[model samples]
Target: MTSPEEALQQARATYEEHARTCRQCHFDAVPCPVSKHLLRAYNNARREQMRANSGVR
Candidate 1:
């Protein structure tokens, strides 16, 4: 079991890495808003899950 803080840190790092590449990827460019939304939701969910789990433990 990873500590909540550690898990959050890892999640943030991964999201940051994706953000760097997302802006430049042709697949992620202007025509697609879907990927951006998906990524946002994913990050939010991960953070929420971490918070919930952290609180419980």
Candidate 2:
């Protein structure tokens, strides 16, 4: 029952926390794979939502 916006906010918060605790020297920042993965996931979810909504109309 949770809205997508709420879920995204939760995800963003979690990402922020991870970034804060992330080891810079141990890992790359600008090219972080986590951000790339999350972006793909978000795009997929948005596409699915649009597809479902279009079908409903």
Candidate 3:
């Protein structure tokens, strides 16, 4: 199983790469469907890491 930190890092990198290439990912504006999915993945990874750090299931 991947560690929470690793998962978060992977998710962040994936999202960042997409945002870098995709024109619809303006930080100030609404994201495209793909961007939205990626953002959700990143956020979920982040939350999982936080939960792990806090010893929460």
Candidate 4:
């Protein structure tokens, strides 16, 4: 299993890469469907990492 930190890093990288290449994400106030999904994933990963650091389940 990937560590929480690694997972968060991967999720962040994926979201950042998509945001960089996706014109809709850059130009539109609302994110595109894929961008939304990626953002959710990144957020989830961040939360997981925080929980892990705090020793919470």
By TM-score, the best candidate is 4
Please say which candidate is ahead in lDDT: 2 or 4. Answer: 4
What's the CA RMSD for each of the models? Answer: 4.8, 4.3, 2.2, 1.2
Where's the lowest-lDDT run of ten residues in candidate 3? 22-31
Global lDDT scores for all candidate models? 0.61, 0.59, 0.89, 0.92
Clash count, predicted structure 1? 0
lDDT of each residue in 1-57, candidate 1, tens digit only: 865566666766755566666755445455245446556755775776777877863
Rank all candidate structures by their lDDT, best first, as comma-separated numbers.
4, 3, 1, 2
Clashing pairs in 1: none
TM-score against truth, every candidate: 0.44, 0.48, 0.85, 0.89
- Per-residue lDDT tens digits of candidate 4, residues 1-57? 999999999999999999888989877756899999999999999999999999999
Q: Which lDDT value does model 3 have at 51?
A: 99
lDDT string for model 2 (1-31, tens) is 6555555565666566656666751275563
lDDT (C-alpha) at residue 33 in model 3: 91
Q: What does the lDDT read for residue 20 in candidate 2?
A: 67
State which candidate, 1 or 2, has the greater TM-score.
Answer: 2
The candidate, 2 or 3, that scores higher on lDDT is 3
Q: Give the runs in model 1 whose Cα sits over 4 Å from its true position.
A: 23-57
Report the error of model 1 at residue 14, Å.
0.1
The CA lDDT at 25 in model 4 is 84
